[model samples]
Each structure stands twice: as structure tokens, then as C-alpha cells.
Target chain A: MFDLQGYGPSLLAGASMTIAVGLSAMVMACILGLVGAWAKLSASYTARATAAVYTTVIRGTPELILLLLLYYGVPTLVQDLASLAGYEIILNFNPFLAGAVTLGLIYGAFATEVFRGAFEAIPRGQTEAAQALGMSRFRVAVHITLPQAMRIALPGLGNVWMILIKATALVSIIQLDEVMRKAKIAAGATHQPFTFYLLASFIFLGITLISSLVQRQLEKKAHRGVGQA
Target chain B: MNFTTMLEYLPQMLDGAWLSLQITGLSLFLGFLLAIPVSLMRLSHLAALRLPAQLYMFYFRGTPLLVQLFLIYYGSGQFRHELEQIGLWAFFRDAWFCAVFALTLNACAYTAEIFRGAILAVPKSDIQAGKAFGMSGLLLFRRIIFPKALRIALPSYGNEVIFLLQASSLVSIITLMDLTGVASRLVAKTFAVYEIYILTAAIYIAITYMLVVIFKLFERILNKHLRTDS
Candidate 1:
């Protein structure tokens, strides 16, 4: 057995931090995704245009750059605005919050596309029928649109989750105590970069492997009684 | 807001942009070339070939590229004596080599999967047609399979190339002066963090847009014969 030099506990802690950051970011991404999908589907020109621009700009740029901008740039911007108002203020974004929010913003653009596609794939007739039956728009969304769209969006959302988890590794650049950062510390201390990085990769591979299995189960449950005899 | 500072940094940023393109272009070309054989191995009937191919894809596709880069770059230092004895330490010592090496390995895994899917999607009827015409082996592949699979894989391959381009930014972490690296350095010197990064983001966006446009044009050219215009 390879010697971890008692760094095993810290690595485990770091792995949990990675998962926590990823889940929190997933929550943020899901909220933005829903609002984005709503905006894209809305009748107003401004809402649609704003959502379009958001997805386009975010999707076109690199995630690391966005993370860096949020980490380094935002604080300066906040301070500059404060100074312009003749009130001095220092703003240092918590690294954990910055990492989660940056990942959320980057992945939310992708989730928006997934949700929009899922929403559009729902047949128009069902919504119209619900409306005709005196169901409110909210009621129609809840009873008709949401369920079917969830079934379709599940696969894409699963994909977003996978990518988002991997992107959490980038948070290590901001000095977050995620698995990658912890592994780097262990590697440096042990002079065993290969061993530690290899283990880190395995941790990520393990997450994806488990997530995919759970996703399959979710997809099956979502499709229950519909595609089978 | 500081137009003067941004203007001064523009040349350095553009130089970094060129280097980024170089790394991306070199890796994509090599990776794609390697992927053909890897994809073929993945599709092979033999368990030996397919098993290794599957593991390679799983490892590369499952892990984050940053880890892979670190493993290749810093990890090699752990075996410096072995590497030096083998006369390969020089290559591993160079950050540029490690960056490209890792990126190419990653690109190969992803591009192989794309090719595998595209190859699978090539119509069975078309392959059968080639067989009926006495085509076999390389002849069949060149005349029938390659062209069709290229068309099918073009879109995903384009996305892969963009991913590689974006992934190339990671090289900056290893101390290479790619676009992101130069931007970070500029930020450190000028303290104009937002201005430098926003400008960098704009450059990345432009390159992404250009790649998309190029891929779309390529797709149009590939499908031109399928057009039914009178």
C-alpha cells in the first residue's frame, strides 16, 4: 500500500469540499437555468434578447477566465464603485462563494440551452388543451409542461452536473481547499506528484462513474410507464 | 475604463493569442491523427484492443484536464532519475512539451469517441454497397467510410477543437505565456484586473465565434452535393 503520510484525512475532507461546492453551484445553475429558459420563452423582446446575450457570451468564453474575473476583477470593480460614491469599502469575495458562483454562471448558460430545448420539445397541443380547460398558466406549467420537460431535461442536466463537477477543479486556482488543491499540497510535501494527482483523477472518475449510474436510474424513473409495455 | 493601459497591453495579449493558437493547432492535429487508430481500436472486435481503448477513453474523459496536465508536467519530476537515464528528461522538463503532451492525450480520447460515434453512424447500406462493388479494406474505408464519417463527425469535432482551444488556457497555470497567462501577468503589473480580463474574454469570444463560423462553412461544403436546389 502507498503511504499517504497521514494526509489521507485531509484529502478526504477536500473531496467532500469539492462535492459541496459542486452541489451548491448546481443549485445556483438550476435556478439561473429556469429563469433563463423562462426569459427565452417569454413574449417580451427585452427578456428574450437579454437571455440570448447571456448564454452567447458565457458559452463563448472559457470557464477559467470567468472564474478568474470573478475572483480578481469583481473586488476591484466593487471598490472602484464605492470610491466613486465617496464611501470607501473593501470587498473580498469569499473564495468558496466566488468559486461556486463562477461555476454556476458558466454552466448556467449551458443549462439554459438544455432547458429551453426540453421546454420547446413539449407539444404545443398539451399546453393549449390545459389552457382551454380553464387551467391557469401556472397550473398548466405545473401539471403539463414541467413534468414532460423534466423527463427531457434530465439527461442534459445530468451532463451539466458532470461538467460542473469537473470545473470545480479550477477552483483550486483561487486557493480553495478542494481535492485538487489538497492533492497538490500532499504531492508537494511528499514529492510524489504522480501518486497524488493520479489519486485525484481517480476521485473525479469515481464521481462521474457514480453520477452516471444515478442518472441512468433517474432517467428510467422519469420514463416509467411511458416507453415500456 | 483605462484605455491607455489596455492599448499598451494589446500587443502582448495578441502575442499570447498567437501562442495559444499554436498550442491548440498542434495538439488538435496530432490528437486527431492519433484518434483515428484509437477509434479503430475501440471499434475492434478483439478484447485486448477494445479493453485498452476503453480504459484510455475512460481515464481521459473522466478526469479533469488540469489534473492530467499536472500529472504529466509535475508528476514526471517524481521519476526524474528514471527519465534522465532514459534520456527523455529533457523533454519532460520543458513545460511546453508537457502541456502539449497532456492536451494531445486528452484531445485524442475525446476525438476518438466522436469518431467512434460517427463511424458507427455511417450507413450499413453504404458499407454493403461498397462490399458489393468489390471494395474492401483501405479501399472501402477511403471511398465510403472516411468521407461519410467525416461529415457526421464534423460538428462534434469542431466542438472538440474549441474545447481544446479553451483547455489550452490551462497551460498558463504551468507558467506558459499563453493568452490567459499574459492577461494574468498584465493584471499583476497594472492592477487593471477587470480591463485586462474583459479584453482577454473578448479575444477568446472572437476566436470561438470564428471557429464556429469556419465549422459551419465546412459543413456546408461537405453537404453541398446533398442540396436539392433547382
Candidate 2:
């Protein structure tokens, strides 16, 4: 029964912020990931090359550094460009927007791989069979390819979600009022750093546990009507 | 695009990178040593032995490393009296010690799981053969199981090493002047955000590339006998 020192409400608020940032970023990541996967698998050489460059650069760098760069570097670069254009507009990034976009971009590299693998796993015959049935490419993707790929992509996407949720804690460095930042403030105020931090860790663990359970359910539904054998 | 600032900060960032390498090397070695016992516990048939190991792995793996670092670095202050009474506060008080301690424990959890999987994948046939040759217990493990498992685990273990290196960036938050820490400091001081951070990212990419090469060579050596060309 460790006392939260009346900061329980703020911590809960912070947890909600963390989830908000994570979900919004995940949505962005999914969009970019889909596009990146499509680019990599496209017939266009330039598209594949650009996607390759994007994923490689993002994947090779540390997430923290990437986040910091976007948080600090982008606004500076934009301001300089604005100066060159003769407009003296000062620019500052909103922490939530920058954090979400950067996190999405960083993890989208990983999600690119996940989606690519999933797309590849879908049988070519399935696509050809849809074509034989005179289905449009969009219809084939929507009906045949996407359904199958989602089933395959579920596990990998689940993995990306777990890592991304944990990564939301790093947004605290950029001054987002997430759970980690809230815990820091509470701990500093109360001087019970261990208690608050341990509480934060448990919150993360709870999220992970619940996500995995949800993933299992999703996997089961995704696999429904298919033979167990 | 100031070349002068980039040149001036390069050496400081390199020094910070050296510290990052030191932290990664020390924690990785210590974590691997700790992982062996943890992995063995994970493999043990008894729930008493397995359950605690599973929990340890679960807790460390599930939480972000930043929380772990804070829980060790800042959190130790909460237990100052108890830790002092036990004479462990001295070590816990040092930022470097806490950084290494947290990173080691975090790495240990992931490495333990990797080792557990690799150890389980070691063929029963190989163990039985070792037993038939009068090998048992430590001898069996040393001669047959470990070497094979080392091969199985190398790829994932190499990945853990890279992850640990990247994860070491979190030590910056705890006031350690690692690569990321130094870059942040330079950014604050010079306001040459793009120049310094870009250079730092390049340095990290180079280090990651080198590690990949080194791991590839190590893997080749470990699996040398499996080569068909010979």
C-alpha cells in the first residue's frame, strides 16, 4: 500500500497521455509503413531505392538520437531556410506533434520490414487468382491480399506496438507530460524516487501484458475459419 | 554548416563515444556472465527455480530501460539509509556504477532469454552422445551443449549487443557523457544542433556497422566447422 502522495490522478493523466501519443504515432507509423512496403515492392526502381534509404538510415541510428534530432534539429533547419526565403518567421515544434511524427518515422522503418515480410508471405497465386477473377488491383489488395497479410502482419505489428509504447517514455526527455515525466516530477517533489519509478515500470508492464493478451485474441480472430491442422 | 564548430566538437564527441563503448563492453560482459545462471534457472524443471527467473526476465524486458536507469540511479537515493547501513550506497551513488548496473541487468534479461532458447535448441542427440562418451554434468555441458548453443545464440546475441549499444544512449539521461549525452550538451552550448547531432548519428551508424562486421566474423569462426567448402 505505497502512498501515491495525492499524485495518483496526475499519474493517471500522464498514463493517458502516453497512450495517446503511442496510438497516434502508431497510426502514423502504419500509414508510412504501408507506403514504404508498397514502395519497396513497387516496380519503380527509384521508389525502392528511396524506401531503402529511409529504412536504413532510420534503423541504423538510435531512437533517442533520432527523436532528439527531430525535436531540436528540424526547427533550426526550417528557420534557416525561412531566413533564406526572406521571411523572418520564428519556428518552434509542438512537442506532441514532433514527438509523434518522429516516433512514427523511426518505427515506420521497422514496420516497413514487418509489412514487407507479411506482403511477401502472401502467395503470388492468390494475387494471380484474384486477377483471373477480373478483380481490380485495389479490390484484390482490399479483399484478398490485405486480409491474408493482416493475419501474417499481426504478430510483427504487435511487436512494433510493444516497443513503440515503451518508447513513449523517451518523449519525456522532450518535455512531454507522459508517465515517465509525471513520475519524475512526483518523485522529485516527494523525494521518493524509487517508489514512483517502480510504479511507472509497473504501469509499462501492465500495458505490455494487456497488449499481448489482446494480440492473442486478434490472432485467434484472424485465424478463424482456417483449419487448425 | 559551420565546419569550425563541427571540427571543434568532434573530439569531445569522440571522447564521449569512448565512454559509450566502455559502458557497452563492461555491461555486456557482466550481463553475459549473469545470463548464464539466469538462463540455467529458466531451463530448470522446478517451478521454484524457473518462476523467479521468468519474473526477472519479464520485469526487465517489459519495462523501458529509462525507467530502470532512473529506478537505479535516482531511486537509490530513496534507500540511502538502508543502502548506507548495508555499505552498498557507495556503489549505488556513483552515476557510472548505476548506469552500468541498470544496463547490465537489462541486458541480462534479454540475453538470458536468448540463451534459454539456444540451450533448449541444443540437440538431445548431442547430449546423449556426450553422455555415451562418459561425459556428464559440467563435462557434458562444456564439451557439447555450450559450444553448440553459443553457435545458435550468436546471431541473436549479436543483436542484443547492438541493442545494448543503442540502449546505452539512455545513460545520457542519468548525466553520463556518452555519445548521445555529449551531443546534447554540444547542441545546448553551441546551438549547432544539426551539425553536431548529424555527426553524432553518423558516428553511431559507423559504430553499428563495425559491430555488425565484427559479429559476422565471430559467427563465421564459431560456425567454421559447418562450412561445406572445406
Candidate 3:
């Protein structure tokens, strides 16, 4: 029961930044996931190859490496172009943007597999019936396929969300002021590493508990109309 | 890329890769050894054993590995004077030891869960059959439970191994000059960030692909016994 005097606001602000990164990354991942899943499931060889490479490369690399690659790596490339153009480059890439995008890219690769599995689980007969009724492929997918696939994807997606939420902590390495970064600063300032680290753990645990409950609710809603048999 | 440049960096990259592999291999080995007992504890009938095992899993799995690494590395460093007095500072003083310790603990939690699932998935009838044949306790576990659990666990354990390999890159933060660390240092020196990172990514991809092949071979070997039984 160690008290962190006057540190509450800093920790809360860090938590908010963490949440923002997680939320934005989740949205980006979802979009990329859907596209990657479609490419993977597509009949075109090039599309399938592209999708395979995306998942393999992203999944193979560590998230931190990807973060540094984007953070330090991309800025150099951008500055090189700026110098070539004879324009004064004033654009500084924020660590937060680099971190969120990197996490989104990495998580999206895993999400692609989850989505592809979910999409594959959908019965072909449902699409056939829609086609037989004169519905176009687009309409059939929109009206019949996606909604059902989402149900199967819900549990796996929930797990990915948890991983993403925890991963936001890694942004601290690149100097983003997330909870872990703030805790590190506080610990350094106050010379109480155990208290601040434990407090950070509690905040993370709290987020995990709340989000897990929300995931269960979403799973329920996603599975609502389906028969359990 | 010129052959001269590649040759110059080859030895350095190879040394880094060796360290990465050593870290991952040692952690995976130790993690699996620890996981077996933890998984058994989790499956135990006694609440006293199960509660602590469950708490261990919950806390380790719930937190990010990076935080755990920091907690062990820097947090432990906060008590360096006391650790020195106890004669344990020598071990914790090394970044390699700290990295391996944290990674092993992290992997143990996840692998234990995988093992628990595999152990439970072993058919109850199989155990009863072993008991019927006068097998009991350790004998029954050895003859029946273990083989079945290993079969079920191997695939997921393979994934965890790959994860640990990837995760070994995080050791760079604690000042271990692994592949990622080398790549970052090269970037800082040459300002050729894209080339270095792309090369590092390629190295990881190659290692990961090899692991996938090795796991597939393991799965094939494990399945051979099952096929004969069938």
C-alpha cells in the first residue's frame, strides 16, 4: 500500500494515451485485416502471394523492431527525399504515430489469419442460396456471409485486442509517454521502482479486466442469433 | 549490396544471430521444463497448489513481457546493494542473464497454459486403461498421459518457440547486442536506417521460416506413433 503522491494525474494521462493508441490501432487493424483476409481467400495467385508475404513478414519481425524501423527508419528516408527536393523539411514524425501504425501493421497480420479462418468457416451453401436467388456476389457477401463470419471471428478478435492493449506499453521504448514510460520517469524521480511498477501493473490489470468483460459482451451479441447446437 | 560490404558485416551479424539463437534456445528449454510442473500444479486437486499456480499464470499472462523485463532488470537494479551483499548481484549484473530470466518466466506462463490444455485433452479412458493394466501415479503418467499430452501440445509449443525467438529481440533494450541491437546501432552510425532494418526483417523472416519447417517435421515424427496405434 505505497502511496504515489501527486503522480495520479500523470499516470491517468498516460493511460489515456495508451487507450487512444490501442483504439486507433484496433481500427487500422480491422481494416487491414479485412483486406488481407479477402486477398488470402481470393482466387488470384498474385493476390494470395501478396497476402501471404504480408502476414509472414509482419508476424516474423518483432513489434519493437518494426516500431524502430518506422520511427527511426522511415524518418531518414523521408528526410533524404526532402533534401533532394531542396525544400526545408520541418516534418517530425511523432513516436506515437509511428508506434500506433507499427502495432496496427503487426496485429493486422495475425488478425488476417483469424479473419480468414472465420470467413472459411461460413457455409458455402449460404452463399449458393443467395446466388440462386439472383443476388450478386457483393450483395450475397454483404447480406449473408460477413455477418456470420464475424461471429466466429469475435472470440479470436477479442484475444488480439488484449494483445494490442498490452503491446501499447512497448511504445515507451521509443519515448512515448504511455503508462509504463510515466511510471519509469516517476520511479527514476522518486527512487521507488517497486511502487511505481506495481502501480503500472495494477492499471494494466484494471484495463484488461474491463476490456475482457466488454469482449464477452461483444461475443454474446455476435453469437446471439446462432443456435448452439 | 556489394559482396565486400556483405562480407564485412557477415561476421558481426552471425555473432548477433548466434546470441539470439542461444537466448531463445535456453529460454525455451528452461521454460518448457518449468512449464511441466506448473501445468501439473494447475491441474492438481489441492487448492493450495492450484491457487498459486493460477495466480502465477494470471499475472504473467496478463502483463506485457516488456514491463516484466523492466521490472526484473531495472527494478532489481534498484536493490543492487542488497543483491551484492547476498552474492546474487553477479548474475543479475549481466544483461544477458536478466534478459533470459525474464523471457524464460514469460514463456513459462504461456507454455504452462498450453500444457494444461494438452494434459486435460488426454482422454480419461486412456488413464483408466493404464490403471487397469496395473499402472498408477508416475507410471501411468509416463506410459499414458505424457505421450498424449506431448502430441497435443507440440503444435502450439512450436508457435510459442517462434514467439520466443521473435521476443528475444526485446533484449536489445537491456543492452544485449543481438540482431535488433546491431541493426539499431548500424542505423545510428550510417544513417542508412531503411537498408539495415530491411535486412534485419529479412533475417527474422528466414529464421521464422526455418522454424516453421522444423515444427512441421516434429509434428510428423510425433504423428508417426499415433498412426501406428491407429
Q: Estimate every model's Cα lDDT from 0 to 1.
A: 0.94, 0.93, 0.88
Model 3 — TM-score against the truth? 0.95
lDDT of 3 by residue, B1-230 (tens): 22345446656776888889999999999999999999999999999999999999988888888888888887887788999999999988888999999999999999999999999999999998999999999988888998899999999999999888988998988899998888777768766777778778888889999999999998998798567555
Q: Which residue runs of candidate 2 sit more than 4 Å off their true CA positions?
A: none
User: How high is each candidate's interface RMSD, in Å?
Assistant: 0.6, 0.6, 1.6
TM-score of each: 0.99, 0.97, 0.95
- Judge the docking of candidate 1 as incorrect, acceptable, medium or high: high
User: Which residue window of length 10 is worst by lDDT in model 2 chain B?
Assistant: B1-10
- Selected candidate, larger DockQ, 1 vs 3: 1
Q: Model 3, A23-70: lDDT tens per residue?
A: 989988988999999999999999999999999889988887788888
lDDT of 2 by residue, A1-229 (tens): 3799899999989999999999999999999999999999999999999999998788778989999889889889888788889988777888899889988998899899999999999989999999999999999999999888888999999999999999999999999999999999999999999999999999999989999999999999989997691
**Tens-digit per-residue lDDT, B66-162, candidate 1:** 9999999999999999999999999999999999999999999999999999999999999999999999998998899989999999999999998
| Candidates 1 onward: DockQ, in order | 0.89, 0.89, 0.65
Q: Per-residue alpha-carbon lDDT of model 2 for B1-230, expressed as tens digits?
A: 67575887789999999999999999999999999999999989999999999999999999999999999999999999999999999999999999999999999999999999999999999999999999999889888999899999999999899889999999998899999999999889889888888899899989998999999999988888899996
Interface RMSD of 2: 0.6
